[model samples]
Target: MNTPTKRRGCFRNGCLALVLLPLLIFAGLFWAHRSSQALPDRFVLVVPLSGGIDEVRNESSSLPFLPSHESLSLQELLFVLNHAVADERVREVLLDIRGIHTSPAKIAELRDAVEKVRKGGKKVTAFLRSAEDADYLLATACNSIIAERGGFLLLDGLKVESLFYTSPLGKLGVQVQAAQWKKYKSGIEPFVRTGASKEYLEQINALLDEFYDDYLGYVSKRRGMSRSSFEALINNDPLVSAKKAQTLGLVDGIASFWELQRQLTRKVSGKELARDNDVFVSGARYRSAVAWPQKGESDERIAVITMSGMIVHSAGEMGEGIDIEMLKNSLDAALEDKAVKALVVRIDSPGGDALASADMLQMLDSAAVKKPLVVSMSGVAASGGYMAALAGKTIFAQPLTITGSIGVYALKPNISGLAEKIGLGRDVVTRGQYADASTPFKPLEGQAYNKFVGASGEIYDDFVGKVAASRKMSIAAVDSVAGGRVWTGSRAMKAGLVDRMGGLFDAIHAAQQLAKMDMGKKLQIILYPEQKSWFESLLQGRSASLSDRFAAAVKQQVLHELLPQRQLTSMATFYEMLLTSGQLQMLAVMPSDIIID
Candidate 1:
């Protein structure tokens, strides 16, 4: 009620208002800045080939909107290299080879792609911290090859070793009960027996020998070294010292990345860069100072379908990447598209979802009859990977392509004895005599055991029959290689399973050939996961930083893992590994082999 108290209250209210007003203003400025950040206009492409194909994410999904300068996808790498050869602004290519991992098939593609750049009157230089034999396969294509100071280049003979785990399973009381349908179907060998089977070893040895020969031949061609000399170098791989590597003529020079950069910018217009990352915004959206030449859209209108990652059973929401239902929808849409002249199903999958593969193949068969359906395989196309290719009018594979595994096996853990050891037993009552047929909780009865084996036999039979008809081989010939088998792309070609040994562009050309198109005019092709547009970016907030993004991704991944699913599986991790050529991948798959949707 006093005048002094009222004045004090008024003073407090004004100060509080002052503090809140500035807070609101700062928040608005931050949002506005993110939305209207200066448009990036220059790009320096640094191609560091990383793992597999990654889909474009929304701004929140991928942040800072940096045009990808770090690691380029196989396709993107080719495009940039192609552009550099002719474009004046794309002066030089700085390729880093520290973490590049790829199969032999992929190695060939990169080598050829870079070689084309050199042929086009462009300068290409490669800087590697440490170079392996495989790394050299790619770097050899570059005009100038530089290795870090004390960085060793050990381009030696290639080795492919198969891992066998029969003894481990035996110690753990694991029983691998199943069939051997093909002479080389050694996928199950690691589970049941120690070391490679005589049948499996024979095929592996033959294939490894072929791959080694091809590798040495390629190095010899690029390095201009004699075959005898190259053989001697390979036998003495893992050079004792970096200085020695240069002395032996295995490397052009040994210097750090900084020295390499100093040499690169010697005649450039702008300031010399200190680091590789600063040279080009890694994983950032490219906005060139000179207008980015708009990617020419396909006018010829050829259909393209993408098969990505390990093909596993389609049950949950299309997890992380590839999904069966998502693919099914794409297939249906492509089949219905009128403008698509023919379909090119690009398969980079290691193979998953046995039933799904069959279903997808059927869709391809339908599309092929209507128009040319060509298959373009990258890196890998094995087991289910090969199965999907069967749907093509013609299949294109890289020479080092990983393919073939034309067989099937069904396995379920029988832990009944484990339960007994734990003083627990499962009892079941069923109206049907064989209702408990697949109860892994209990031991298999004589009659139930017979039924399980018989069922697996029927499924394997169905698989072989399809292979015989698709490859146009006799039942006998097909059987010779159809049991839970595996084969490299080169071997698959000789076996008459794959149509040709080539790349994606080759597959596109094959499509043109199949349709009898003119060679002089460039062809238009339709590809899946259509590139994102700038319009989408303008509407959303700027992409977040890496730390913020990683936190969000972890949250989403955790929720998906803990959620309920309507499917069954046995050993989710093992299935994924089988698909990815022994690369360990873990999935929370159900306990039985079934697809819910």
Candidate 2:
């Protein structure tokens, strides 16, 4: 028989073993997973392009072990493609396109990257399943385009739809009194009229024509066909079957995903793949396994600041829109840093508050005076977005970018009828004549209306003045292009509003040249207003509170249940416009909301 002390020691040892066993197993598995991340000596890198591609990666999950559903960023994808160009282990790039959604400008950038990979002696193939026009455009850049059997290719032509809220708002006893700078300042039309005005339709049609021509021209030239022939093919069969697409020379071949994989294996390794894991590496895995090349041995740095979304005065805790305060802080930091030699500002906004835009323009102008500055316009940069770009020594935009709506407007809502309908009453007492002028219970009239109009006109004049000074044009010349007219990037370049037709990398190269840095040498690129992790944002109280989240959820549910999708979207747009303008503030927003599909 064992002694009591021996028995106690045995029990303690058993408990310790139980706890340590799981820990040891977990550690072993972690190491195994890490080791498995290594790339095969010769493998095809599968890059999945799906959903919305953001400009920067956002960390959604706080825990490393948890799965993340975040969309991949263009920068991340470009980085991967650039690295693959040099990595000998990467035999080829297989782009798996599945309902990819992004701007045409981004698609163009990606297409260029694909061509670069091919030039680097690596074959790039695109695999499509139920692809659309944008998806097909990107695939055209690949060496060969393969589609799944029974898949459909939707190549419908482009059309823009503008929503009007005047009738519905009138039904609800709400009237929006608006003042616009000129005829083309049609941002107010949607709220004031039932349909698009002549000027709006004219500009929109021109944009569509340009986009259609460019799309047809690129696809035709790439596929070694005449533009007229390609256009006719699209017109005849807007939605063609994968087999039909192959017959029309749109795709190279049709095969099942498994068959494609087998073919790729044979092409790369000269034999069919015995195991999937041994021959193929995912883009995510490759990103983690391979290290990015180090920058050249230099102390110089180039700071890249992205001003996206609406230009707001401040983002506060919500972190929505392009916060001017955050941007100013980043600019100040870059200006103070001795290592930072140049700055490239990437803007993708549809404009917002006039004052905020002016502040941004001023800040950028000051920075430009101190150092080399270049502006890169993404997707839509109009109105106040254009205002901000005036500070750049040289501005760059893609051929399809929507820009230039240089005007201002002011709107005030009169809800007295609604209050009456809802049986609400209020009695106001004020010493000043205009103290109650901003109250929604009363419509702005007489002196109040005059004051609002005067302020808006002044803002508009200031906008034109800034443009004239920046573009080296006469005030009259700038005013001619002003009046809230939107222009495609190519048109903007022709109008002297943009200096170059290029993308983000082109702007960076221009900055490097201006800074007198080596053209071939790599420099440290620092992104402004660095993205924060979800946990970090929460710790800093930037994430929404529980109450706010609940309120937003309830509001969304109520709207979805009450209104049709189209009407709800229009209402939401109107609400956002109101929020952006605030009370008695002039707005330099786009003439109309535009989304290219």
Candidate 3:
């Protein structure tokens, strides 16, 4: 009844439909895989506090053919800990702290979370393969600490190391002229001096003593030992074998991981159970299950804006760093949100560009007028970090947080000697005598040098004045403790710089009190500058060829060996600060890159 051409067309259309159906089915299955993954009803959450904990998580773009490497985030980890404590399905928690590298304040926050879980009647156990000062400090927060048999325990007290670039610069025929507002402002010392200045040594030693005392206090209280006895144990033998540490009562037991799991199961149920009978869920997996908005039908919210990393004009890439433009936008968004009852600004920065810091301070100051604002200082909130904190109604810092480096300085790099050594010359034309005032090829002198120093003095005066006004102290009192000197949070509190010693959540509660919100109520905490979507991340990520990756790897290794990672990051930030200021400008950056181990 039909023509042969019509029959052939129908046959081709049928083939097309068959091919498209399989593709659609595959896509649907792939999309629904996450929903199908079942979470255990009764499980122990195993949190791997391994590797560096970035303040925020950002995924870079890569080819579809490449594998993805995702790291854990501090914010998400904290959220999981909070959720698990209240989660009826979670019975216990196990923290695996092998090969974990993080700053002191982050460790403090983690410890606080662990303590919360313990107080919530859930058993928290920590297992360490190699225990160091930071790792042991975190382990003490757990209900029980387990270590691998014969593993190394390096509880040696913290020491901060600094590198001086004077000799190296001299050999390379480079001249670095720098000026600070005061004598104790040592941010420029590394490039100008061969050894640690007397003031710098005094401040560093005092800080070390404060941290050591705090560490001893915590361990002694947790282990039920006298402070004197604990000090003796640490001083007599800071480094010991895992078995020795267990014998000394530092750790509860030394056992293999399988045995530890069995022990944990018994602790949870008071019955010996086989490893296979136990159910465990990873932190990331559990976060996926629980880290969603459980917002009580209330419209009121509390905005927690995280300003971590170097404070710069802009953050070009993801990683961790404070971008002024981004922060301003976040503040504007929070201000615009009528439901936001209060604002909590968490700062973990060693500081950066003065202008950018000023801009952020202005934004925060403006916000405080509208809402109750509180600041929580993390690991290293010195220099411009402290500058920003002045805007807060109250400031809270972890006991070991480094702060109070309220000073300013400018650096001028003169490479004329290096150029001459290489037999290079340049012909320049200028309209004014100081036209090339900021050029690295020539030395700054005469009126140029004086002007630079004067500007630095002005910025320092401004910083000190702000601190005096905020802390209700005299200019002399603020300047006496300032001059680029860093302080432990305890000392800062005593000095009237910090209001109290606490973690970020504590600051949030403080904000609540100020906002007249009820205590113990779970208020919605909103993160500003919301994270990007997967598609947006892919667009932001620009993939490089294999050769470029190798080069970057090599460069990273060299920098790692040459200096601490923080120092390298600070150096990059320093250059960025210069570029943003567009002049021989002053910087409100920490004098020393603090690294506690």
Candidate 4:
């Protein structure tokens, strides 16, 4: 057939495929939606936030989510927590943070959610066989925090770490090319050089100082002490003993499990209970979500979009963390709704995908045009993660919240030398120039390297310009901190990077203030999309097509294993993850390294 005839045939097929796509999508959504309604006879709200969200790196082992090393998503797992809230048949709420797994943000989120349930007249008893930061944070949110008689209460302050590679790379014939507009744009230096450059050290020390300051400040706030007092206690401060921690007002009181449970039951002796919060909400909540009047609600509306988990390029939250498509769909849906007057963006991430970050920033810029967009920083928001927040009307980061790292970087490993050494090499044939720009078959040339660096510069420029316009700061001011340099929420606020220092609840409050609502007025928060059911989880693996499983496996391995990860990286992935409210626990390191040596 001629080219025109083939094109015509292809066009005809495309139209038919388009027609069938929506029907299939609707059918699947409906099925999934309905399936969630089916509940079990007894459901235990398993809120295990013992570890931080693990990123996908090159893997040596399978099943990172398995028991040996379970990377729990305290954000996504909030559904299991729903079982404890306002349930008449759910006699009690059990919090097992003893064998903890979580980032401070997840710990805080889960803790707050648990606290809310306790406030709703339910008995919440947290049992920690031993105590760690994971146990302590969640314990504070519980009605009763029980520890083993001689268990420890590890409430130590935040610690920062970095992996220096400059020295090691030199021993080998490896060459690393690094460039950026700002002094801190040393994200690539670590791969080729060991030890940090003087400038890198200065920048990191400042950033870490701020991070530590914020952590101390926030812990003080939670513990009902002044930041000064907390700092005074932190010099050489490892909790010598749990008794000392108790004396220092780090915990309410130390008690055995039985005693803790007894106190909780007594305190919760009178309130109503249920199997799950759904029944309680159905039976006795303020107004039925089902009720509708002939007249619509007032013109006033607020859109809350959550950016959760490690942001990636694909499906936002289907099987993995933040997917741009998932978030873009949510943003588009909310924007299209006339009732949505403004948007509250919840950003939670440790950053990923520089290109993805820029794409999302464009999406946010588009959304901002139609409605006011405010960003809420959860836990650690850095690098490409913070890039996504630039388009918001205002950005909120917790005092201890990690922010900054407004930069772009890309790492392409060259295995050509290894292949040659092993006498196993592959040849490439390209139809056009630059076809091998990023291929692993050979080391990048000056031309290719220059091209990549230029691209990164363009991205960094874009990042600064957007921030400058959004925050109304000068280009120079934004440049000072834009080169993958991180900062604390407090420091960011001072630098105008973050608009306010606050928590999720505080973020909601700030959003309400922006919307001009009363301080005490309750704004009905509409969570994005919805959580999937247990059956879906069980069937999610079952329903996976060969392609889906293959994709998942690749992602799991590439991100978790093959991918050489650093502490703070990927501005793009961070932003997307915030949309889904997933946990991302990244290592403690600068975006890149710079060597003064």
Best by lDDT: 2
Clash tally, candidates in order = 18, 0, 1, 57
Q: Give candidate 1 regions above 4 Å deviation.
A: 1-44, 50-61, 65-71, 270-294, 315-321, 443-445, 515-525, 529-572, 575-597
Candidate 4: give its CA RMSD in angstroms: 11.7
Residue 98 accuracy (lDDT) in model 4 = 55
lDDT of 1: 0.60
> lDDT for every model?
0.60, 0.80, 0.78, 0.58
Write one digit per residue (lDDT tens) for candidate 3, span 418-528. 888999889888998888878878878899888888889888888898899889999999988998878888889988999998987799889989998866667878886
Higher-lDDT candidate of 1 and 3: 3
TM-score of each: 0.78, 0.86, 0.86, 0.66
- TM-score for candidate 3: 0.86
Report the lDDT tens digits of candidate 1 across residue range 69-114.
3344566555456556655555667777774555566677778778
> Best to worst by lDDT, what's the order?
2, 3, 1, 4
For every candidate, C-alpha RMSD to the true structure in Å = 7.6, 5.8, 5.5, 11.7
Q: List, residue by residue over 478-540, the lDDT tens digit for candidate 2.
A: 998888898989999999999999888789889999999977777777777665433344345
